[model samples]
Target: MRILNTIESALSGFLFLLGIVISLYSVFMRYVLGASQSWATEVYTMLLVWAIFIGFSTALKEDKHIAIEFLYDKSGPTMKKVSQVIVFIIGIGFSLFIIWTGFNMVLTAYSQQIKTIDLGFPIWINYLIMPIAGILLFIRFCEKAYKYFVKHEEVTHGGDVEWKQ
Candidate 1:
């Protein structure tokens, strides 16, 4: 679990840094060099996609995914657990759907040899980020569910909560 968390964090961090660097370079090229590469936009778009996907899993592992806590905080432990289960099921289902659809989309893109307007780079490569991120999210969801049901552990007040389900 620790290793998974570390890997997810590292991946997310690397994607984020990569995105920042690419964006900065793009900006520098446009402003300082007075010329923009046709592929700059595509590069940024790809980086953003990767960052979003990796960030999704990292957020799940960190229990930083968005939620409405007003009602949850007022509920009892049993209710909390029930809520967690419901959320997990729904979240996992949605992530799986994305993975399925994203896979098909990537396949179609690859088969068609889709390319961006300005860059002419293979569009499938950019679309691949969706499935990759979806898979990571699915893994994180399973880990959360396992910890919730099998580990039966609670996070401390100041510590990160092992998301129940």
Candidate 2:
């Protein structure tokens, strides 16, 4: 589990850095060189997508995702546990929905040979990030659920409140 978290974090960071580099190069080429590669926009868009989706997994692992903690804190431990369970279940459902929709979107793009406006690069390749990240997020949610219920541990929310998850 720890290994998975580390891998996700590293991958997210790498993708983010790659996106920044690509975007910087694109800007430099367009302004400094007075010209830009036709594929720069496509590449940057894909990189940004990958960074956001992969970063989601990292956020989940670190419990950095935003939540309204005021109410959860006021509740008792049992209520906190219940809230965590509900939240985890909802998160799993949402991830599954994203995976399903993303899969279909990618499939359609691949089937139609979708391409970028200027570069003609395969669009499905970019869309693939959605499902991959969805799966990662789903796994992370399941891991949290296991730790919450089976282990009966409380999740510390930095100093705000202890969530029984």
Candidate 3:
């Protein structure tokens, strides 16, 4: 799992960097050189999509995702455990939904021969990250559930955050 998380982080980081580079290059070409690249917008948008979806798993592993912290902080121990169970169930359900819908979307795109507007690449390639990330999310959520419930470890969720007046 550590290796998998490392790989996920690397892949998402690369995609994010590539997206930023592409967007900067596009801006430089348009403003500095007075010429526009037609494929740049679509390419960067696709890269951003891939980066965000893939990076979600990495964020989950690191516990960087946002939560309603105020209510959670006020909850008792029993309520906290109950909340964790509820969140775990919801996470599993959402992961399965993402897998199912994302897979179907890819199949549909492939069958319909959907292509990007500028680059003409198949749309399914852009969507391939969805199910992969979904699977990763599922695994991480299960790991967290086990650590929290079975091992009696506390699941951190923004407890240290200080609210501003």
Candidate 4:
């Protein structure tokens, strides 16, 4: 899980940087050179989408996702613990839903022969990251659950926690 998180973070970072570079280059070409790179927009969009989806796992691993902590902060210890269990259940269910929907989307795209406008690659190539990232996210959530419930570790990856167990 550690290795998977590291790889996912690195890949997402690389993709984000590459997307930025591609967008900047396209801008330069269009405005300065009076000619745009036709494939740049599609490629940049694809890279950015992949980066965001892939980074979801890293964010989950690090506990960096945004949350509405107002009610949680007001909850008691037992309620807090129950909330954690509920959160884990929801996360797992959401991940599975994403995997199923994403798989269906990929199959539909493949069957329909959908292609990108500029690059002409199959649209599924861009969508392929969804299920992969969803699986990684599910793994991260499981790791969190194991650490909290089995290992009895506090699940705080450098986040502010106003409540105590």
Candidate 5:
């Protein structure tokens, strides 16, 4: 699992850097070189989506996603555990939904011969990220739930987080 997490992180980091570089290059080309690109928009958008989906798994592992902290902060340990369980269940549910719908979407795109407007790339290739990331997120959620419920531990990326401590 740790190895998988590391790989996911590496992919996410690569995508982040590539997306920024491409976006910057696109901007420079548009404003500095005076050559408007027809494909830049589509490329950047796809990069952004891919980065986001890939990053989602690491974000869950790091516990960086948004939560209602006000109530959680004041709650007791039992309440906190309960909340975490609930959140984990919700996350699992959503991830499953994404996996199912994403598979359907890819099939639909493939069957219909859908393509990106600017580059004409097969749309299913882009939609493939959804199910892949969804599975990753679901596994992370299950891991978290196991730690919280079975091991009775608080899994956090930052042991020095002042608020959590």
Candidate 6:
């Protein structure tokens, strides 16, 4: 899990930097060189999609995903733990569904031999991010679920408790 997290984080960071470089280079090519690079936009778009989906999973694992924690923070220990469990279970199920559907889409595109306009690559190569994201999401949620089931809970002195990842 640790190694996977590190790889995801590094890939996310690299894609982000590479995306920026691509965009800047595209601008320079268009404005300064007076010649447009047709492939730049398509590549940048693909990079953006990959970066967001991949980085999203890492963020979810790190508990950086956004949520309405106000009510959770004000909840009692039992309620807080229960809410977390409910949320994680729902997330796991949703992720599984996404994985199933995404894999189907990838397979369909592959069978159809769909190709990208600029890159002339199989479009499935682009849509492949969907299942990859779903798998990462599933793993992260399962890890959280495991923690919820196996880890000892923190007993609080206050009436309300705040739950962090």
Predicted structure with the largest TM-score when compared to the true one: 4
Q: Please give each candidate's TM-score.
A: 0.87, 0.90, 0.92, 0.92, 0.88, 0.89
lDDT of 6: 0.83
lDDT digits (tens) for residues 5-84 of candidate 6: 88999998888789889999999999999999989998888888899999978877767777767887699878977887
Q: Go through the candidates in order and give each one's C-alpha lDDT.
A: 0.79, 0.83, 0.86, 0.86, 0.84, 0.83
lDDT of 6 at 37: 94
Model 2 gets an lDDT of 0.83
- Tell how far residue 111 is off in model 4, in angstroms: 1.4
The runs of at least 3 residues in candidate 1 whose Cα sits more than 4 Å from the true structure, single-residue gaps closed, are: 155-159, 162-165
> What ranges in model 3 sit over 4 Å off?
159-165
Superposed by TM-score, candidate 5 places the C-alpha of residue 25 at a distance from the truth, in angstroms, of 1.8
Can you write out model 2's per-residue Cα lDDT over 23-131, one digit (the tens) per residue? 8998999899989766777777787789889988878777788877898779997897788878998999999998999999999999999888987889898899889
Pick by TM-score: 1 or 6, better one: 6
Model 3: which ten-residue window has the lowest total lDDT?
A: 156-165
TM-score for model 4?
0.92
Tens digits of lDDT, candidate 3, 36-127: 99899998888888889988888887878988879988999789879989999999889889988889989999999999988889999888
lDDT of 6 at 63: 72
Q: Model 2 off-target regions past 4 Å?
A: 159-165
Residue 8 lDDT in model 2?
Answer: 80
The Cα RMSD in angstroms, rounded to one decimal, for candidate 1 relative to the true structure is 2.9
Q: How many clashes does each candidate structure show, in the order listed?
A: 0, 1, 0, 0, 0, 0
Clashes of 1: 0
Tens digits of lDDT, candidate 5, 65-88: 876778887889789778877888
